[model samples]
Target: MSWGVRSILHGLDFVLQNIAWKPGIDSDLNVWSTRWVDGGMPEPVDFLLEEGFGFMKDFRIKDLCYNGGGRNEGMVRLIFKQESVDKILPTPLISTRSHDEVFWPFSDEVRYTVKSGYGVIFGEFFNNKGTLKDKERLNLKKKRFCKTTLWKLPGPQLWKILLWKIITGSLPIGSEFIKRNLGWDPFCTLCGKELKEVETLEHLFRDCDVSSRIWFGSVLGIRTDQNTFLELGEWIINWITYLKGQKENYYGLTHFLVTLNSIWTLRNNSIFRGESFVQKVFFKQLGSLVSLAIKNPVMKITNDGEGVFNSNDSEDLEDELNCLKDALLVLVID
Candidate 1:
């Protein structure tokens, strides 16, 4: 038994004690002896304990009410008062064929419910309120995002799904497709490099010239380099942890995630379609994507001590969001 149930029974032991089993075909209850009437004697028999009411040879307390009405009205009148008879007749009989059953008076239903039992114990104190903890309790001024918090980033389901795929290293990039024997070329879809490389998650999300341009669009004047592409998943974790602690980074990471999602989407579209992975298109798509996905009223717009976003800054923040999640996940696992 759970502590909730045990505590309930412990607190309401008296209620159980007062509950007497009604007689069935077997007639287990001694009607005169049982305490049924308002926790008092079942019947107000004038005779003492030495002199019983009478041998109830045929009828039983349980059989008294079989079909919503009492079969032994005369016998009931003989032992119990009009008030007692009234209470007994409409008691919603336990059984007709099987032996009599005992039930909690808290519920009219046959089975004891968890909600009823829970209510009996903790109804007054149970909290139905959500995870809305008081801010003063923790005194947390700024909401921070870390590796664990990344999974809970509330936005479009596709965004979260892609993120999960990225972290798992199962994203449908060219190299991943060929690894599964999907019979496809594993070359960069977004880059116009002379010598193409296998379009791995590392190449798609980072290292690609197109993606590098997106990062260059950030207002933070963020620069992408060799380190930015190494150990993608660990970098993400470090990226989040580092940014979370810095007031300077603030909500700047939002732009990063958006930029990553946009570049990936464009890369996917460019695989078969004629979608452009140009820096301008990336910035245009990102602004619209972030606005539609992140509709929360309290969301902050971070300015990285740079001028407001314009056409020139598009590449700075654009592909800066794209980073290798799956590659790092494999590295982390290895």
Candidate 2:
């Protein structure tokens, strides 16, 4: 029995001691004459007295003992049996390797991601650390060209196009038939000048006295009446190259690109539309193109360095004013 129950029974026994409700040989003999240990108590697993030993609490009291008395003989026997079984069983051995090395589970995506991120781990194990660090480090300032929105293009591509345009201007010295075939001259329909080998692509676009006046007087607001052929072409290339460098200058870049596109469009219109390229009509169209370009994401120039732009703000007023003047003359009339 547990200690609690044993204590309660001991108290009951004390209360009933020496109480004679009837004669010793009368009803009391049948009631209290039979002792609890004689028949009512449970049998012990083993008795300390049978083993010829005195009760000693210190001698192999496995876990719990009931006051160093004979009451816990069964619990003591149980503890000794448990200790014997534990001694017969061997302890388990643990492996020295890490969990990943010894008990790794396979996962296709995890393995692929690791391999793709760092290449093969075997190479990393064998390669020099300094060499690996150098290969991975990025150096932005060493780049030859700034990134542009036009497919992340470099400045060299613009230089190539400008060079091609210059070469086309020198190709008219071949023959009279070649000059007429290449849209070089139509007898200057207005001035009736004898257009010959001197009338090249550059002459058509910039050198003609009529086109030169329109270009310098209105758009550039500078006198180009005495400007040389090389000077005008150089100016145009420099303007485009600078605009491309400042790609984030959306308000300015948009005006520049759209104006260039419109100028080419006007040239084509004069060649194929069968209409005289009047300066006033062309300027109005160029104005519309500039307005449309400002609203779109094309050169998204913002006042702040981050490139946030308002289509109608005085912040880019100077760029807009210059762009408007240049675009009107270059695209519409020049």
Candidate 3:
């Protein structure tokens, strides 16, 4: 085959592997073989083929839905595993009668694009080669935290990218430097010279005394030392998930991101500028950043096709700032 044709075919293979089917009337998609469910690659149901149910192998997704396009819960629960059922039921059918459409699940637009396709291919390349540690790679593929939580967060794009780097171990920290043989000291500089602990992502962010103090001193009142998760990625996922549940306005998440940014900045200053971690200065700067984030919150598109701020009104903003100030007041730094 010609090189051009061969390249096209190679790209097509990657496209097909990552694409998922969005059920409309669901008449065109085979339930057992099509990538109709979310999470990962689609596979046939794991049940043994029975005498009378051989015909089910050819069943389309529409067969499991009512004539009006609602899910046929009885047949779905009976035929598919509970895991499949859980994913299938929540998937909304098209309001009008239409054919099923193939979509790129990784992008917000749900349409195939060159950028997203390349991202999927690149991610898979590293994942297959075991470049990322096992638990981190598994969490990335399974949870899809970037698409689900990080991208949806209302903040500056830089802030989101920083969070992504931290989760993915893409930051140029001491451990990463050691891995690349850059001859930089890999020990936690924030923990001082006497302690001599290697600065892994977890230790720098969560386990170090300085970072732990920052977390504890924040308005969120998080105690990093009390974190139970073994993996830093998992630990962050837990807190982000909790923040999502607890706050409707996303103030908690915004504050959390700001605090993380401050901690990182503090670490950098300590390393590069020979600065010491001062509680008063750090908290003062953190409060200003938080206030700045509130005043200029991210803009989001509303259901009515209007762009609105993700922040509260002046009065509400004042109240929130006061609350944060009051909380910070209780945290005394010697």
Candidate 4:
């Protein structure tokens, strides 16, 4: 096929064509080449005249290397090849972990997952301590939180949890949400004292003296200062590590998740609704969920909303505040 300067730089030619060529901007190659040729003139005006004239005839002196042919063609080919090669280089890849994964892309949850799962040497999944095998490790330690409750479903649950764990990483590193929020001094909604940063999830659920006085007392019957809320997975990992010899308590695991979820829900309601952040309210919610869990421990869930709370769990639903007392009164009637 016949080739020309336009075809030699086809892609660049297309781009330049679209750009609005203003007079001052140097789009005029005739003036540019003429100036370059005049400035770069050698001691041979007679040689320049002898060469066949073309678009870049003055600048292409190097291309006419053939004894019989002119140097103008050689210079044109050299410049064209150099410019084309410069444009041919591949573009650098610019992507994020979230673009391919199912997590909230910007959150700080990935660090927590890596810190918890790998400690320092973030490596293959299977090499880790738990059921996560190396083959499953997707190096998703820094991805966005795609979903939680993946285990409650099926297939590639580990990857889903890995993603969710990253989202949970956004949980304030310190226990104090108010302090973490920056700017304003975040006072406790219940008691208007400035909160400390290290008072995070486990603190709110288990360790915070205020929360401890309520839910922990009602549920585990503990009234102590030592129990803090560990990230649920971390807490489980610790328990599994400690109780390695004992029979696995899968039921206990389910119960623990339900209870924690209940407590977090209550905490949010109390903070946002101006509802009393009292221990009694938490106990009431805890009691209802516990009672339901006791009766229907293996509650199933499905994507189409087919199997959420079991039918039995729905039978005795009552106001969380009055549910325990309401059940007791029903027993009295019977």
Candidate 5:
């Protein structure tokens, strides 16, 4: 490759797949070599780098993340200043547990964007250099949100993405709609609040009295307090952690995800359908969906329009298939 093409490709490679920094299965990021610090240069791992540690390989950021005492940490402290260590501390990481994950840095929903790619490759073509939005800001959100294993829950891929978007403030809520000059009333459609307090992720999911009741009455029985969790990302991580801790309730996480999705659906209903908020039916449907998810862990988590039924879960699938066939037959007849 020519020098420019080679540089562009190298930058593109970094932009395309190298940016997001989720702590996947044993996947640790170096505070020095990797771009973990957003738009900020890393403080030197001076002594170790002299020995060619970061350039040579095998060593990683996760190596420093261990709760175990001494050994590497002693060297790490000596090698890096307190200021350098501080940046890595608030990584929104719970390192000891979690499976592998891949996320796009452009959006919290992990939706990859060409704009993000351009910004990365062309060096702030779209944003100011060294600013929060210009660099690893997108990757930071990726790291926090990958903390949730909602994708492992039983649901359609799009539904999972929708919830992820909702949690990340990327969904087209009233606030976003207003940004596009869509003539939206910048308030809680449910509560009719003022423009300053629009139906944001916090409003739709937690702050709204209607959504709060859904959480309070559910099997999880947890209502989010903005005083405790200023951000939806924090609230979601805690929620997922709560569900994961419930060992006896294997379906707890699934239940939480399903119920949240239902709540969001109701929010849409209120907005688009002009439907009044109804709690009893929402609760009933949530219960049913949770049960259905337990029986079919792959309920709608696929994209090709086919639900994968586990061999152990073949019951009633034939009848459902037959019903689908009959519906298609009716369409053909008409």
Candidate 6:
């Protein structure tokens, strides 16, 4: 064969070996030979094979399911051993009653793409035991989280992009500039000369005295310096995910994003305009920003005409307002 044709054949062989059949109504997957199970093994081991069922070796996956697309549990239990039956029983059948699809198992969407294919190739060639390394796995997780959760967050598009930059270390912070050898000083302008902390995303957003005060004084009352997370990106993901889970209406998340945006705005104002951090002014701006977010058309108001952003009870609203009042007391004390 020609070299180009040989290469194509080799690629085709690799694809065939890795692709799996998603069970559908018209599945043509062989009961014995197809790698449709989770462990990538073919169904029905040699020891599990009964002499009487030798004639059924050529049967398709559809033969084990009912016409209405439910599994034939009785027949499956009788024909296959418990191990094979265990694997087959949990395999989800497509609800659409369509033809079976061949899918790449590694991707989130289960469709073959050049990126996933390249990842598979890289894992096989460079990784130990054909698995992704820790860094690769983390990158994959971040990509998935961004696609499914971060990008879908309710806010202005610019806010989401800013968050993306922060998590990906793409924000033009001083530490990032130093890493790129851009001839910029890495010391935080926000923290001043005496502290001289490096201006990393984590330090600027979470560890700095200014930022920590804002977080502690906010309605969420988060103590930014107390977290155990080593990385800012992971910390943001974990906190945001927890915030999202706290309320279906996303009150905690909205407050978090608004507070974060306000902090960034304050940081910029300090750097560009030589503005000093004022607690009263910062708290006022934060309260207004959060209020605006609650009033935004995208935010769902409660049914009782209370104009509350989330589905939380009136008691929760009272508690939040009381927290805000307490936060304002910090301005007096400072």
Q: Could you say which candidate leads in lDDT? A: 6
Cand. 1 Cα-lDDT: 0.49
Can you give the lDDT of residue 71 in candidate 6?
A: 77
Tens digits of lDDT, candidate 5, 1-334: 6899998887667754445454532455545555554234346666666776555355565565455411244545665666554443333343345543445555445556767666556655234533344225544554645554645545455456776786566887777888889996767766555445677788887888877888888897875553443466555655665455444565666667766666666766666667666666667666765665656543633442223454444556555445433332222111
Q: What does candidate 2's lDDT look like per residue over 1-334, in tens digits?
A: 9999997897556434312121111111321122121111112224443553344322332122244221244553453343222211111111121111111011112122334223323443123521222222111101111222232322123322433344334322223436558654533322224543243444554555655654554443334443343333343444444444342453554454454444445555555554465767666775676665565342355543223333465646556545544543445443
- The C-alpha RMSD of each candidate to the native structure, in angstroms, is 28.0, 40.8, 9.8, 25.9, 10.3, 12.9
Q: How badly does each model clash, as a count of residue pairs? A: 16, 2, 0, 22, 2, 0
Model 2 lDDT, residue 231, Cα = 36
Name the runs in model 4 displaced over 4 angstroms.
1-167, 172-187, 190-199, 222-224, 227-233, 239-250, 294-334
At residue 115, candidate 5 shows an lDDT of 74
Q: Report the C-alpha lDDT of model 1 over 1-334, residue by residue, as the tens digit.
A: 9999997888578456434454454444655545442223344435423354345533245545435333466666666665456445433333344565454433334235666456446533223441112231111111121223554443333455676567556677788778889887778867753467788776677677776777777543445573553445433444443444344554555666666676766775676565555555456656655553344222333343111222245553343223223221121111
Q: Pick the candidate with the highest TM-score.
A: 6
As a whole number from 0 to 100, the lDDT of residue 122 in candidate 6 is 67
Identify the superior model by lDDT, candidate 2 or candidate 3.
3
Against the unseen true structure, what C-alpha lDDT does each candidate score? Answer: 0.49, 0.36, 0.66, 0.35, 0.57, 0.67
TM-score of each: 0.42, 0.34, 0.51, 0.35, 0.50, 0.54
In angstroms, the error of model 4 at 116 is: 16
RMSD of 6: 12.9
lDDT of 4 by residue, 50-93 (tens): 55334445433223323432123434434443322221111111
Model 4, residue 163: distance off in Å is 12
> Where does candidate 2 clash, by residue pair?
250-299, 250-301
The segments of candidate 1 whose C-alpha lies over 4 angstroms from its true place after superposition are: 1-147, 291-295, 298-334
- Overall local distance difference test of candidate 4: 0.35
Off by over 4 Å in 6: 1-133, 298-334
